[model samples]
Target chain A: MEVVIGTIAGILTSVSMIPQLIKVLKEKEVENLSWMMIAVLLTGVSLWVVYGIMREEWPIIISNAFSVMVNITLLIAYFLYKEK
Target chain B: MEVVIGTIAGILTSVSMIPQLIKVLKEKEVENLSWMMIAVLLTGVSLWVVYGIMREEWPIIISNAFSVMVNITLLIAYFLYKEK
Candidate 1:
């Protein structure tokens, strides 16, 4: 039961950026999306990956690595869509 | 070392939404902020809170609960600030 809940929780949080990423792609509007939020999230998840690697925790590494990738993609889109 | 890394990672991720929240509060522009993203995150962290309760982990409970509050506030602000 805990595993079930934890897995769902992990997956949801890990991919929470996807919706925003899609919105950005379709709408090309990022006026309200905070770059600091994305950057902090990127840093946090990157550190989680490091922590997981250090602890040899595959679950943490995989989940957070995916988050890192998504956030990086979001960061790129933020740059592209941001008004000059 | 792992604990320190994990603690920092946890702190950063747990409070990651704060910058976005502040942006929304100040700008009153939520056009680019996806409700789906915030809703998914709110669900994820709320589950984490439940999992923490089951496992009797105070840190998890406290951190995730804080996230839940932040996400809820963000959700409310999203509704208020979102363009009609």
Candidate 2:
């Protein structure tokens, strides 16, 4: 039950940015988005990954790893869109 | 060391939304923002709070608790500003 709850939480956090990502991509505008927020979120997710590794928690590790990827993609998109 | 890392991560995640929140409130616009993303993020953060409670992880609890508040504020601001 705990694992189930954790997994649901993990999944939620992991994919929380998808809609935003899609919107940003389609609109090609990121003027409203904050680079600092993205950078800080990346840092937080990275630390969570490390913490998960230390605790040998696979769910945390997996979810945060995916979150890191998503954040990186968003960052790149923000830069690219900003450049246009 | 682990605790320190966790705390840092918590801080980063907890306050990550401030800049965006400020932007949204100041601009009084949320047209670029995705309501679906915000809703999903709220769900995710809420679940994280629950997970933290179950695990007795105060850092997670505290950080996510703050995140929940921030997200809720953003949502409200998004609607209010959106209406304008």
Candidate 3:
């Protein structure tokens, strides 16, 4: 039950950026977005990954790994669009 | 060392939304913001608070508590400014 709750929470958090990512992709604009936020979030998520590894928590590791990927993608998109 | 890393991560993640919050407050606009993302994030953060409680992790609890407050404030701001 706890695992189930954690998994759901992980999925929700991991995908929370999808809408923003899609909007940025569609509009090719990031003027309203904050790169610092993304950077800090990426850093935090990375630490979560490390924490998970230390605790041997697979769910945390997996979810935050996915989150890290997502954040990196968003950061790339931000830079790419900002250059335009 | 691990605790230090986690604390810094917590601080970064907790305050990640500051820039966006400031931007929205200054502009009084949320046209580009995604409420769905905020909703999902709030849910996830709430779950993290639960998870932290279960694990007796004070950093997780405190940081996510702060995050929950920030997210809630952002949601309220979104609605208030969104109407303008």
The DockQ leader among the candidates is: 1
Clashing pairs in 1: none
Which regions of candidate 1 are displaced past 4 Å? none
TM-score head-to-head 1 vs 3, winner = 1
Which lDDT tens digits does candidate 1 get at residues A20-73?
999998998888899999999899999999999999999999999999989999
Docking class of 1: high
> In candidate 2, which residue ranges exceed 4 Å CA deviation?
none
Determine the TM-score of chain B of model 2. 0.89
- Which stretch of 10 consecutive residues in model 2 chain B shows the poorest summed lDDT? B25-34
Per-residue lDDT of model 2, residues A1-84, tens digit only = 777887887798789888999999899898878788889899999999999999898877888899899999999999998898
Give the chain A TM-score for each candidate.
Answer: 0.95, 0.91, 0.90
For all candidates in order, the CA lDDT equals 0.93, 0.87, 0.84
Highest-lDDT candidate: 1
Position A45, candidate 1: lDDT: 95
User: Which lDDT tens digits does candidate 2 get at residues B1-84?
Assistant: 888987788788778888889888888878778888888989988998999999998877888889899999999998888787
Which candidate number has the best TM-score? 1
Model 2, residue pairs in steric clash: none
lDDT (10s digit) by residue, model 3, range B1-84 = 777876776787789888788887887878767788789899988998898888887877888788899899989999998887
TM-score winner, 2 or 3: 2
What TM-score goes with each of the models?
A: 0.97, 0.92, 0.87
